[model samples]
Every structure is written in C-alpha cells, then in structure tokens.
Target: MPLYENRINALNTIEIDQNLLKEVQVGNQSVAKTLVDKIIENKATKIAIEGWYGVDFKKIFNLIKEEAEKHNLTVTGKSSAGLYKSSEEIAQYSAKYLTDDPSFGWVNSDGHLRDLLNPKALQELRDLKSESDLLVVYGPGVAVEELSDLYDLVIYADYTMQPMLWQMWDGELIPFGSDEPDKNYFWKQYYYNDFYLLYRQKQYAYTKTDFYIDAVVPEELKLMSFKAYEAMIDEMVKYPIKQVKIMQPGPWGAYRYRDLWDIKGLECNAWNELAGIELSILIDIGLEKPINILTQNIMQRPLELVGEYVHKTFPELFPLQVWLDDGYFPEPVPWERSSMPIHNHPSTQYVQRHFNEPLGRYETYYIVESYKGSSTWMGYKEDADLEEWERLCRDSDNLKVIPNWEDFIKRWDTNVGDLFLIPPGTTHGHGGNQMILEMDTGPSIAGTEYSFFTYDFARNTWDDNTKTMTAKQMKMHLEHSFDNQKWIREGRVRSHHRPRPITQAGDGKYRYDQYETIDEMPFHIERIFMEEEAPGDTQGKFMQIVTLTEGERVTIVSKRDPRLRTTIDRLQACVIPASFGEHTYYNESGRHAMVVILRLKKG
Candidate 1:
C-alpha cells in the first residue's frame, strides 16, 4: 500500500457534473425578489437576513421589503444598528486588549460584536412579530444564538471581492500608505481583530442560514442552493487550481518582478503572500473575460478539496503558503543593500497559545537567481552573550545598538539551487540580488507572516510601514525570542541546512534532493532534477506543489489520463491535487529541467 492508501480509499473522488450547476439560479434583483416571495408564501411573519462582516445588506433587505408591501403585507425594516455598543466602548476595549504587549493576552476584543448585541434589540425584534405582518432584520451577527428564536425565517447574504492579477484584494491592502500612524494602529488592533470577528460571524452564518446569495458581482444575484455550493466545491477539487498573484511594493522591494511580469507603472519589489489560502478561482464562461470568484464562498464541502484527514485536521482552512520574493542589487554591492530586517518568527507553542493558531511558521528559501556576491543571514554565534544580544535588540530603535552583524549573525554565501531552512525563532533573512522561492508552513486559519525584528541597517528603511516596529512590539519580541533562539557554530548551521540526496530514478539520471526536515514539521521540501524527461508519481500519498525552478518550461502529464496536462513556465508554480495519483514531468523544450516540490508529510 502507498503512504496515503487509506486516505485515498476513504475519499469520495466524485466529480460533480457541470450541467447540474445550471439548476442554481443566477440573476439580479428579480431573482432576489423571487426568493423573498417564496419565503412570504411559506407564512413567514418575520425574517432576519445576515451577512459576513463588512457586507452591507441594506439593498437586499430593501428589495425584500418593497415586494412584501406590494403583497398587501405591512412591512417593517429594523436595522441591527441598535445592537451595536457605543464606539467609545469598542475603542476602550480595543486599546486594552489589542496592543503589541505580550502580557496583554487575548486574540480578540472583550464583549465584542455578538457579546455587545443589545438585549433590548432582541426584545424589539420579538415585538415586531405582533405589530407587523412582515419584518426584515439585516446586519452582521443577526445569526447569533441570541437572535435565533426571534425570526420565522433566516437568510444569509454574502459577497466576495473579486481579485485582479498582481493586485491586492479589497480588504487585504492597508490604504493611505503604511507610514501613516493610523495605518500602524489599525494593523496592531483593528485589522487583525476585525478579521477574527468576521471569521467567527462567517462560521456562524454557515449553520444558521436558510438561503444564500453570491452577491459577488454587484447588480447580480447568483442564487445557489446550499447543496449547489457543495457541488461547486466538489467540481473545483478535481482539477489543478491557481490563485491570482499580487505584486507588492515595499521599502526593500526591487524592480525585477515588475520587469519580468511586464507590469506597468510600478518599479518596486514583488512578493505574493498567502497564494494558496487567500484564494480566488478563475472560471472561464466562454466570455472575453473569465470571472474571478473567491474560493471561500464555495468552500461548502471542505473534505472534497483537502481530503478526509486534512479536512479533519485542518477543517477550517488550507495549511500551506507559497510566496515568491524577488530582490535585486548590482553585483559587487554592499551586503546591507539587499538584506532584510533581522527577525524571527514565533514558536508553534507561542503562536498557538497567544493567537489561537494551530501552528507557528517554518519557512525554507530556495534560491532561483544568485548574483556574484549573493549571501544570507541565519542563526547566531556560538559564544554570543545572551544579555548583550537582548540589550542590542531592545535598544536598536534608538541607534544605541550597533555591532558587527557578520561576527554574531551567521552569514552564508549563496548560489543557485541552494536551500536554507529557517525554523521558528531562528533569526534569518537573505541578501539582495537574488530571487528566492519561499515555501512556508502555516496553520489553517491564521495566515503566517509573523516576524519580530531585532535590527535593520538599511537607510530610509523605517519609512516602510512594516519596518516601523514600535517599542512595545520590540518588548514583545524580546519576551518571545528568548526560548526559541538557537546559537550554533557556523559548521552546524551548514550541516543542518545542506541539501542531501534522497533517491535516484531512470538509471540514476533523475534525482531527488531533500533540503532539511525538522521534528514534527507538517511539510517537507525537495528538488526534482529531470535529465531530459522523467515520470513523476504522487503514489496516492500527498498533494505536491511544483514550481519550475530552471529551464524554459515543463509539462505535467496525467499518467492515467494523458489528455489532462498542465504546462508551467519558468518560475511559475502549480498544485497537484492529492487525488492525482500518478503523473509525469516532461521537458517539452528537450532540455534538462529542475523543479522544486513542496509536499505534506506522509503519515
């Protein structure tokens, strides 16, 4: 039996027919009005409509009310505004619990949206049933347990923000630049807390909803049955999927990605964060432009996409992230030019306890392009004074801490095809003049970009929003970094990170090389070097994410179904679903190709 034999046997790999999708209605105001009328005919005296956070349900509610009044039923509109606590109350609690202080422990605000919903408002909702023949209540948290009995019928109205290639989605980007003080404040408190709140509300809406509307495309109501959404996810899981990539500009960002991708009007660094998790599916409806749909909206059946074990282990989310880091600096330049801030990620225990995440971050860097003077920083000196290191990091913001970084921090010269393992709490960063593929492991729910910086020496670096690490944040870093820190000699660092041969294939022409493996890591990294062309198989074990690291291009051919093929260009990545039992990597260009593969650990 193969590694994932049991999983494959347990999984129902049924591909939902596309024709069945037509059963779900897709239209505009007319369709919504029809749904409202259906509820009214069912003898519903009062109805409550809920939506995901940040969604305005007023239009949907008004349309329903207009139709209700036309039917000679007395209609009443009751906004959920009265349920919200005063802004002062929210602000005061936000200040107390949402700061960077590690001692200020809590992932969300106290007495938040659901907790603060006014009891008096619930009473009013109950009273409306006696006074009016029809009542419409709409807003976030309307689906909470407290409001469950107040409605005769409950409906969910949700919208997905469409994504554009090389652009930030509507809610992810921090507008008004990162240098703004308010932006910093928002990220520390409001930004993260709001996401948690939204995530909770969305989870509640899943079980409490009677009907759902995919209001993603404004002026259109893509009405889908709850089962139709499940069918959609089942169909989506049968094929290879790609998420739209976004380009980001930062203080340390370079222009290589901009020029490579032919992106106009931007000459800065480019990186794609949370590519697999924060997703959008590209659907081709035979139109000039394909629609971009958020994957979260269609994730009604999680098991279909992630398999049985993964669904059980990480039921709420996808656990991996692939990020591309493109940096540029001329050859023979100072190392400081390309270096990122000296920082470390939190440990699994620390993040899980504090942020309610399943795991902390562990990343590995695969070098794609390495210049003459390319290098990276990792680990700490063997004899480094612990107190001195802490003092320097704590006082770095005031410029009172300056030390020969290369002496205390282990710096390694780099070349193409090199991989560096950065375990959590490891102080590490790569230099400029290199393009690196960052393969990281994250928990299902929390997107992983947690870094605590000790120092950054580049000029004007602090101007970037992310680089502005406040004193309070630095203190938090100090407390968290102590236990996770590893001080080892230069030789041990190399021994730990150096890639070793794993296996040979096809008369030893094809080879597999493993980067490194930490205990209990959820994923592993390897490089596949194909001499001319070679067959690759997943063996029903784990899903593999492959990136063409070298050569012009490579095609992935389905071993069982030859017609199923995907071509990946140089530096492009694709996912091989776990259900794709066997495949082959062919160098259609008739040249040797090197592909980097990241896969989940085999049980």
Candidate 2:
C-alpha cells in the first residue's frame, strides 16, 4: 500500500475527522474548550493502561487480536517491525540485552520506536486501531529512559509546557521556556513507583549500578535527568481523570453498547505521574518545531475546565472511585517478591506462611467501607508499613505489628481465606501471606520503596554497583516494610463485594420511602437451612441474604429489646438493614429457615 494511503486508511478507520482542525482563537478559554471538546465530540477516548504484565496486557492484546482478524490490516512492514514514517512518530529505539537479565532481553535507551516495537505487537495494535479508530501509540518514555518504548509516550511538565505531538494536538507551542525537570521530579527507586508494574520482585533504587541511592549529585545534567523521572510521576498523580469515562463521552444518542452506571472518578495515578514527567521531557526536546507550540498549549490548559466539561457530559465522572489496580509493594532486593519467596518480614511473615502458594488459593471478597462521603479515599496519607522487629528474643516494646484481619475485612465484604497479589492493584489491607504477585506500571523495580520490603533475617549490606544484596540489604531486610514510594502515583484501590438490592414489597404495610415505620443500616445474619443443599425460599415474608449460588438463608440473634414496635415478618420477604439488632436475631419467632440478614442504605 502507498504511504498516504496507509496514513489515510489508519485515520479513516478510527473515524477521526482529519478535515483541517480549527485553529485557536488566541487568549481565549473557548478555544481551549473547543479543542478539548472536539476530542470528545469525535467520540475520542484517551485511555492509559500500563501494559507491562503479560496477562494484564492481554486485555488490549485480545482487543487488538479480534480487531486485526477482522480488519485485514495485518500486513508486515518493511523491517517486519513497522513502516511507521518518521513524521508519524516522535522517536524510535535500539535495544541492548544482558546475559543475566533474560526475561526482557532487549533494553533500548534511545532512538526509534521501531527498534523496540516487535513487528507482531505493532500489527496487533494497528489492527485494533483500524476497527476502533483509537490511535494507540506506545509511549516515548520507554525509548528515552532505559526501557522498551512499547507505546507512544506523553509527559506532563509542571510549567505551561508540552512536546511536539501534543503541540500538534493543540496547534501551539509553549510560551514559557521552562526547559527541564527540577529536583522535585527525582525519586529513589527505594519508593518503587509504588510497586505497581515492577511487581513484588524488586526494590525501587536497586538497579545493578554503581550509584548509592543517597549519594548526592551536584545540580548537574545527570542530576536533572534523575529528577526528570520524579517529575514524570508527579504529573500523572495529580491530573484528574475518570477511568469509566475514559472509554465513553457524549450521549449514546438512542442506544449504547454498554451500561455506564458505575460512574467512577478513581484514577490509576501510575500512568498519570509517569505521563506528567514524560511530557516535561518531550516539551524540553521539542523546543524548536511547529509541534512545540501546539503541545505546549494542550498541556497548559488548566484542569478545572477539563473537569467541568467531563462532568457536564458524563454523570459518572463525579463521585467516581473504582480504581481496579495499584502495584505497590516496596522492596529492597531486585528479585525479592511478596509471594514468590516468603521471608521473615516480621509483620507479614505469618500471613505469608499460611497462604503461601501451592497450598492456598487467592480468595475474593467485597470491600464494604471504602466510601468517605461520596468519593473514595485514594490518598494513602496513613501508609501501613512493617516496622523494625526488636526481637522475639526480647518482648519489651518492639514487637513488629502484623496487619490485622480487621484492617483487611473492615473495608470490603471479605472472607478469611483470601490471598492477594502485590505490586499492581494491591491493597495494604490484603497484604497477607500469599506469593506476592508482583506486577507494576513501569519496568524499573526502583518504584517499590514504599509500604513494604523483604525483611533480612540477618543484617547484610546492599551493593551499590550490583544493585544487589550486600550487608545493608540485610539490615534493611529485617522487619522489611519501608513504604517510601507512596508518591509513585499508581492508583491502588481497595476492593470488596456487594449484595443485591432489598426494597419494600407491595401490600406489606411498608412503602419504600414513606411507609416504613422504622429504619436501619447494618446487621449480623445467621442462616437456618433445612439442608445445606436446599434451595432457600426466594419467596415469602422472610429476611434473607440471596446469592446467585445454590442456597439462601438468614438468621440473627439480637441482644437489644424492641419496645412497642411490632416486627414486620408477615410479608413474603422484607429486609431489615441490620439483622434485628446487635448480637440478637429475635423476631418473636424461632428458627425461620432460609433467613439471611444484611446491612444496606437506600436512596
């Protein structure tokens, strides 16, 4: 196929109107508004997912697979890599591999996206773009910063700045000459990018290099570069975004493919932070071209306007907090993972031993108390970490405290038997004994310096050059829970389960909003079953908990006394938020079969 033909084909497939985009009305909010709105108007959806993990990346992989099979745009390029024009992308890469690190063989630090993009993977992404029309580019950061430039990169700098691609997106250049990342942008791998994508395998700053983490660099170019990494993360952390809204904007017109009921605003800040800092670098590199102007304008647009428009267009953008993943498990060793090799990290060691793999399975449960008012509490101001264990040998005031079951179960509807994966989408509450399932946003293991680390049984030092274990690696290993990467910006959501809705029935003397004589919220339920196998009554004047499973029942014994209130148990099924009362399930009746109780709030 011809060059323009391919470009036009790619553009046409995503249905983006390349009909000479509107130029900005200088110094006008309306122009910015129009630009932002235009992206949404075209039904554009800007999504960010760190696709490093093989399994998680499979989600997009599958989407591309299905789309490519249908689109037939699966043609191999000139290099069998990609024929993507230079003008099409900002950069490319050349990978270098080491004998020791074989899992991810090629590590590219500079030049060309093709050098890093395996032909097959790009084909899959392109195929998806054909059917979906969503321009999916691997980020530019990977190529620049010692990792695979798998996706197109977009960084967010602090000053009103942006890169070439973004300048083109907005049609302007950055006015302020804030050329580089400052000290505010640098981070110790000790923090571990909040341990999301790097998984539970390694620590934040434990790169097999010669620099001590705390070794100071006089404000030099290298120092500025180090800070640039920090800057990238900071930007993504604060940019307001809604995950659910990322896929859809505007109305369904008459019909929509999926329901957007669970409108959430929770953000996976990992991408946000990374993008913020990365955008800074791009703006720095793209100072001269036409793109420099446009990208700057796009990034400079304030967050208030963007947030407002999104709220106006999508109802779910407000009060949204269903962030599904956060890969934070700070470690000191590159390969020391949560569940992989269980250690005596004092606090979490017991839990790890109990649920350690082969013998235990990861359990799933619902989070009951994540909501604070309307929005979810995303900021981990109260970070949980394993403290230094004084000794089992001496019990003065120094026994390291283990994370409690109460902490784990209080937020969600959880069971005791559950195990959790670490690094990405991990909750500190669920930081129990299970092989740490390490999966983080970026590949740098230096992001996991927060929340927890592997406890060293005997003191040892970590090597500066080897990024490996030494004596310090041993001292830092005991009690092993230093969670400094809290600022990594990856959104780690605490999760739980929910029961179906319970409302008032007709002719039961109780009307939903107006007829109920009494009201309640939570309850302890006990289920009396005729047989464990019996299909409990879905019909009747019985208070019960129902699952889509095989059985149903409810039973609660109350400790509180009911004054003159007549208990309403005559209807086929009626719900009392709390099962009668605390410690008592007395209904003036005995042993009601198929009875289950629950706690709920109705709007």
Off by over 4 Å in 2: 1-20, 24-185, 188-322, 326-603
Estimate, for each residue in 504-524, the C-alpha lDDT of model 1 and write its tens digit: 544566677765576635678
Per-residue lDDT over 1-603 for candidate 2, one digit per residue giving the tens place of the 0 to 100 score: 000000000010001112211221122233223323333444433221221111112222233334433443231111111322332221221112211221112221122323333445444543443333333322211122222233232212111112222232333321111122222221211111211222211121112211111101111101112233333223321221111011111100001111212223221111111111112211121111111111112222222212333223321111111111112322222211211111211112222232111111111122211211111112132343223222321222122322331221123222221222222212233221111111111111111112232222222333323433332322232232222222211133333222223343323321121111111111222232232222222121122222111122222222343221112221112222112222322333343333222211111
Candidate 1 clash pair list: 253-269, 254-269, 338-432
Candidate 1, 53: how far from true, in Å?
2.6
For candidate 1, the 10 contiguous residues with the lowest summed lDDT are: 1-10
Q: How far is 549's C-alpha from truth in model 1 (Å)? A: 2.2
Model 2 residue 550 lDDT?
12
